[model samples]
Target: MNTFLFSLKVMGIGLIGIFSVTVVLIIAMVILTRLFPVSAEKQDEESK
Candidate 1:
């Protein structure tokens, strides 16, 4: 019983760690995409 409880605790911690990493990566990707947006073809043609 004790071993089962320990395994459960470990699994819970592992899940939380994974969730935090995923959230951080998603936030970073969003910030980067906003900072470097793609130009439209019309703008490119006008600039040339």
Candidate 2:
């Protein structure tokens, strides 16, 4: 029983760590998107 409980605890901690990393990546993507805005006119000009 004790070993089962320990395994459960380890799994919970691993889930938390994965969740934290996902959140960080999402936040980073949002910040980068805001910093790099795309414009249609800019693309047309660059193509010429």
Candidate 3:
């Protein structure tokens, strides 16, 4: 029972770490995209 609880705690910590990193990465991607946005005209020109 003690080991089971310990494992659960570790798993919870790992989950939290993964969630935090994912959120950070998503925010970074959003900021980068906003800072250097791709225009529709550029895409249309490239499609030729």
Cand. 2 Cα-lDDT: 0.90
**Per-model CA lDDT versus the true structure:** 0.90, 0.90, 0.91
Alpha-carbon runs more than 4 Å astray in model 2: 40-48
Better of 1 and 2 by TM-score: 1
Candidate 2 lDDT over 2-46, as tens digits, reads 999999999999999999999999999999877766775578779
How do the predictions measure up, each by TM-score?
0.70, 0.67, 0.69
lDDT of 3 by residue, 9-38 (tens): 999999999999999999999998887677
**C-alpha positional error of residue 20 in candidate 3 after TM-score superposition, expressed in Å:** 0.6
Off by over 4 Å in 1: 40-48
Compared with the true structure, what per-residue lDDT tens digits does model 1 show for residues 1-48?
Answer: 999999999999999999999999999999988776676555777899
CA RMSD (A), model 3: 3.6
Pick by lDDT: which candidate is best?
Answer: 3
Clashing pairs in 2: none
Q: In terms of lDDT, which candidate is stronger, 1 or 3?
A: 3
Alpha-carbon error at 16 in model 1, in Å? 0.6
